[model samples]
Target: MTAAFTVRVQDEIAEKLDRIAALSDRSRANLAAQAIEDYVAREEWQLAEIQAGIDEADRGEFASANELASVVAKYVKAARQA
Candidate 1:
């Protein structure tokens, strides 16, 4: 079972949503609900990870400077390849 609610979106965003819905052969409401669900899940995960990091910091747990440089160097190497 599900509950219904009303929402207002900007014209451009609504149009884009409509276009995607039509292309995907889905109702606008279904697409909107799915997008909302996905967004909420992603945000919840991000917030939890942030809180965990804060707790770690509070506990005085941190990476060594060499560990940080190693991570940064890996990214820099991958970026240069790209």
Candidate 2:
């Protein structure tokens, strides 16, 4: 099953899409559909992760002080190195 729809984009974006489509040897519609698919999949994963975190919080699940400190120290060390 499939659905058809129309969307509007800025001229610059449309031009960029056209260029990408040509370079990839794909039609504009195909490229657009793929882009939409990728975006939807990424958003769905992020939403699921966020909901899981909320559920965990509701159940009082959280990292211990040492765990938090470990994460912070890891990032701080990385930042200092950068």
Candidate 3:
């Protein structure tokens, strides 16, 4: 089942969507839905990774922020020298 809704976009964005639709031989609506679906999937994956990191922190399976910062600084210094 699908529901229809109206949306307003900037002229430039609308024009780009039209061009994409023409080139892809897809309706603008279909392209918009696919784009939104992809965005949602990416966000879900990111949230899962963040949750795993939080769980690891709760379990004390991580380094101190200062230690991490020092390691990062060392890498940055090496990159700068290279």
Candidate 4:
């Protein structure tokens, strides 16, 4: 079961939400919850990656400049091909 919570938005943001809700035929609360869920997931992923990087640094795990260039070039080539 989920519980209700209160959130406050400025007038302009509220108006935008209202318009989106009308166009999508969804409730304001539903759109807000979806937005919040996405924001939380993205932030959590970023935080985990940052922590992993810090842990790697603590163990002195790093790539050389040439190694980095090779990986970047591989992806760039693939992106251009796509």
lDDT of 3 by residue, 44-80 (tens): 9999999999999999898889999999999999999
Give candidate 4 regions above 4 Å deviation: 69-82
lDDT of 3 at 66: 98
Candidates 1 and 2 compared by TM-score, better number: 2
Worst 10 residues of 1 by lDDT: 1-10
> Which residues of candidate 3, in runs, are more than 4 Å off?
63-82
User: Would you list the C-alpha lDDT of every candidate in the order shown?
Assistant: 0.97, 0.98, 0.94, 0.97
- Model 2 lDDT per residue over 1-82, tens place: 9899999999999999999999999999999999999999999999999999999999999999999999999999999999
**Per-model TM-score on C-alpha atoms:** 0.81, 0.90, 0.71, 0.79
lDDT of 4 by residue, 1-82 (tens): 8878999989999999999999999999999999999999999999999999999999999999999999999999999999
Clashing pairs in 1: none
Best by TM-score: 2
Supply the global lDDT for candidate 2.
0.98
Candidate 1, lDDT over the whole model? 0.97
Candidate 4 residue pairs in clash (backbone atoms < 3 Å) = none
